[model samples]
Target: MKTETGTPILWTAADAAAATNGRLPARLPAESSRAEWQATGVSIDSRTVQPGDLFVALRGPNFDGHAFVADALAKGAVAALVSAVPAGLPADAPLLLVEDTLAGLEDLGRVARLNFRGKVIAVTGSVGKTGTKEALKQCLEALGPTYATAGSFNNHWGVPLSLARLPADHAFGIFELGMNHAGEIAALTRMVKPDVAIITTVEAVHLEFFANVEGIADAKAEIFEGMTTAGTAVLNRDNPHFGRLLAAARTQGLGQVWSFGRHDQADARLLDCSLHATSSLVTADIRGERVTYTLSLPGQHHVMNSLGVLLCVKAAGGDVAVAARQFSQIQPIKGRGLRKRVPLTKGSLTLIDESYNASPVAMAAAAAVLGKADPGAGGRRIAVLGDMRELGVQSPSLHAGLAEPLRLAGTDLVYCCGPNMKHLFDRLPAALRGRWTESSAELAPLVAAAVRAGDVVMVKGSAGSRMSLVVEALLALDQSSRAGSAVAALSGS
Candidate 1:
């Protein structure tokens, strides 16, 4: 891929101003000596400004980018996009002032999306949005040049920033859109106007903000509000709300609606599935033809999700086999399900890092996968759980209810943290509650001490609970040991 020069290359300043609704300041430099200069890239952070890159001086709630205009200029930024003039910038520096930095970013994203020549796929869900987006990016990239949103950049600011930074000539683009409030998706989707939209599954997430699960469903369905008339909407047939989503798509006048799940009549149906310790072999009836493949990632849920990805690839005008083959390279994202091997004094151990975010639905699924985990030779299944937040008035009962599934899944020991999780801790059979802590930080040491060779440790919690901290603490122990060569001699000849 060609790299964009980090310089202010304006095709037409008038067009830029028009796109942003003429909020630009008059005193700023408008005419340039050269008409065809190169823009290296766009950035919100002035510290990363490169030569010719346009520095977007956005005003954040805490810090103002305008404060860093001098830094951006010193770092070789050719122009600064701002809502207000800063104190230290030179009078001659080019400035594209707008009513708001965030809004300006949206306008720039809209313009970039409109000018691009590639197919765009937008993904959203209560869960699996990031994982599925990563999967689609992996699959789609194999067929042609592809661009995808980096990390979990699927928010109000992230969506626009991703779209604005898109390279003009890329072959394909994938974006993940997320929201917990009404109208949020509508606003973000309007900018991308995706060629294909994938709704992974609607679940009870962000329940604190919603009146009920149906409200969350309505909010998620807003992804179709800005979809192009000819675009396709990929839905999950396994989700109970599939019918509602289907009707929503129809109301939006979407030309195609594809479904994926275990249902026999789904557009992309899972005919059979075999889950192993680290991967799953799946046979699916995709549009009538039976195709079988091995998923590099474990979990039956992932196998079902892959159907959505395959259908989306076809919708995006790419070859299905090309995309399917790319699955071999897909791995779970961190805090989602990325597994690791840690060397302990007793022996090497396996850790399932699902500390990213959790809901009751997802937690149950993770427990099931943990139940089937390969303990190597003598390992036990250890589940380290934290609070699953935002269940509304049913929080306590819902928390306690997890005990049944954990027991059914044959979890050998359960280590729990957080107040809400205490309910589950109390409800568990005394033998199953291995340890409990008021905070994840305090529980980290107990977990490390209890882990044995071949044991599979699954850590999970909602984002608000910060369960990733415990995951980091456990992984860091391995690094500290490695640094001291504590385990090197044990395995040596």
Candidate 2:
């Protein structure tokens, strides 16, 4: 495993000061020289600061990061970026003094992009943004040193942080852009200025803020704001909003637009797919060449997203055949579709952890993947679901709408939680309803108790729904069972 000690020095005091337009303390410690100070990495959290990290003290409404500047410095940080010095720190400490730490971080990101000479790609969508971004990263890594947004850090602060951390010599950079309201992507994209922009697909996500799906599509289209007529735009041809997105890209003066989907006219077209419980075999035509590969991730959603990844690789001048071959190495990210087997007293059961987040479209797609799995002998397919938040007035109907998909998935039993998911529970047939509760805390134990050997279980919901609690409870069963076995052996001895 790679450790912080192995990381190369990423920033120097002189370069950082020039990038952020920040100033060093008037008088540094006698032993400390500006040219001698270096940071191996950048961090925002004091708790996770490494020995040579440059920590940025960001202030928020509920918490002031200035209070942790001393703590970060004590934890081996080379220096801290601060709007104002903390009470305990000396005026001559190794610090980057800026007007505002957040803006300073953004400035560092802007300058980093300006100095970078590599090909950059930005991805945005209601769903599949992170998955597609990760896929692109995996493919691009085979060709050169690649930098990508960590996890799902694609927000206002996350994008800038990812950019600021971009190494000066990387060959490629992939970024994920997300939004809950209008114009968010526009600001982030202008900072990115990607050479290739991709919209995996737009759906009824973040409807709580938008008037409808069209508005969401328009918000996603803001990713084009940073690109000029020379750059390429990648769209999902199978999506209903494809025409809208295509028009928007044209309006933004993008000179080239490439599309990926199962549609006949798609530039990167999926010709066929053999979906399995944990992986799939896909054959697609990129431009005019036929390419086939195996994807380790389950679900048709991922297969479709893979097409977009190829288009990005081609647009960025990467070897299409090499990128296509890297698909087999890509695995499912945690809480998205990560699958594990839990050992019970007599046997084991499969657990698909999709608890990180949820949406109507994502929920339906997950159900489709579950339907493809072949449960063990006497095992049944089960679902434990919580609410899909941020749906506005359609929350009730959207929750209830999941009943059809779950039923079609051949789910034998279900555990439901949250008020919105109660709609789905009530809509389910009596024989299919295992339990229902007002919260995941209340539902976790019930589902954990009811699950048995020979069961294929899936737990999923929005982050706010805290469905991960239920997943934790289910996993804890294995630990308790092992403890009991140990106790029995000790008694016998």
Candidate 3:
């Protein structure tokens, strides 16, 4: 069905009500004919609701989405899905009443998956899931209408929300599944039921919750639980847990297991690659055919993940050549290796914002990118790092271990924050130490002040560490300096 705007209708009131076992608004008659009333999209946040969206009022520990029902309607939401009737809404407000809003969302997602007539792929790993999912989306969209999870929406609620947003006529669907503990992926994967599953590579992330990396591998292996016997499992060949994940996938009855890496026996094997500061040139034997492409995003991690993405495209019967060609168009998103120049008085300082999240492996990758960067004349490589969270008892040692990578990266100056980061700061050479603070808030200004016009600064930390504060501080420097110059000019005039 299409709306008057020629947009494809995503859901009808009748179909949605039946899908979620919800009751229509009281004002509507039991058999009222409202087939013409349809939604063009689905949204969970009231602030982002579009004109013809079905806004699901999800509840969380700190907040209830029901409170925003009226606001969502005012902002053009066609109807609000709520478990309880919110007070202060108009008498004729459109609402779909359900026993539980979250369960209702799950129902919508399950029904959508059941109705979709397309190939589905699920991605899960300690890192690179979002990048791989986004890459696949770009490659598949070149062939036909493709739907994928937005950003890193791969949790329990996030997965269902992404699934519920799937358009009815998409040719391919990709979902990223993430877990901090065992059984989380099992629950999410069952809902996705992807035909192909990709485990990018498991690492020592979220180690606080598990006994060791092996436990993390077992938890990641749960991505195979929802697959049928005929599905394909894509494993990372070079990772230490490859055998464990492969065994689990086979035991779960997956029909095909494909591997990608520099290893000799990898199905999608890397033939050659050059990692530059902002891009990578790669030649790989994908399945059987040798393909070469220049990926715009740098780093070996990205290079390896690209092989998995192309293998997925081929596994789903997409044109490998076309998919390989699409790699050049991909760029890094913000807080994920996005590079920009901030104007200073003499020259501009390069800023690499990797402040979104961090783990040991991710930190090393970011540092490698920093190592390749070309600092301006008389400039130096600088790293402003925050704590890598959830490392448990290994947190201190792991934190200190980062010293080697930073030193090898030729980092001229280093600023560290958080209690865990103190270990790393102490490990750095005396000449490389810029400052160490108990928190990022205290560390931000010092790093911002120390950056010179010719320097290149990279800020990175876990989400909980609030390392973005340092990036914000560094960015604000340009504006403040410009303001000061303007004021001086006005005074002279």
lDDT string, candidate 1, 322-351, tens digits:
778788778888899999998865577888
**True-structure lDDT of candidate 2:** 0.91
Q: Model 3 over residues 1-493: C-alpha lDDT tens digits? A: 6877789887898888999999987555643443225888888998889999999999999889999999998998888889989999876678889999999999999988998889999999999888899999989989889999998989989998888888878889999999998889999999999999999999999999999999999999999999999889999999999999999999998889999999999999999999898899999999899999999998989999999999999888899999999999997888998898999767889999999999999999989989989999989999999999999999999999999888888899999999999999999889999999999999999998888888989999999999989999999989977887788899994
Q: Model-by-model lDDT, in order?
A: 0.84, 0.91, 0.91
TM-score of each: 0.91, 0.97, 0.97
What is the C-alpha lDDT profile of model 2 across 240-328, one tens digit per residue? 99999999999999999999998999999999999998899999999998999999998899999999999999999999999999999
Worst 10 residues of 2 by lDDT: 1-10
Which candidate has the highest lDDT of all? 3
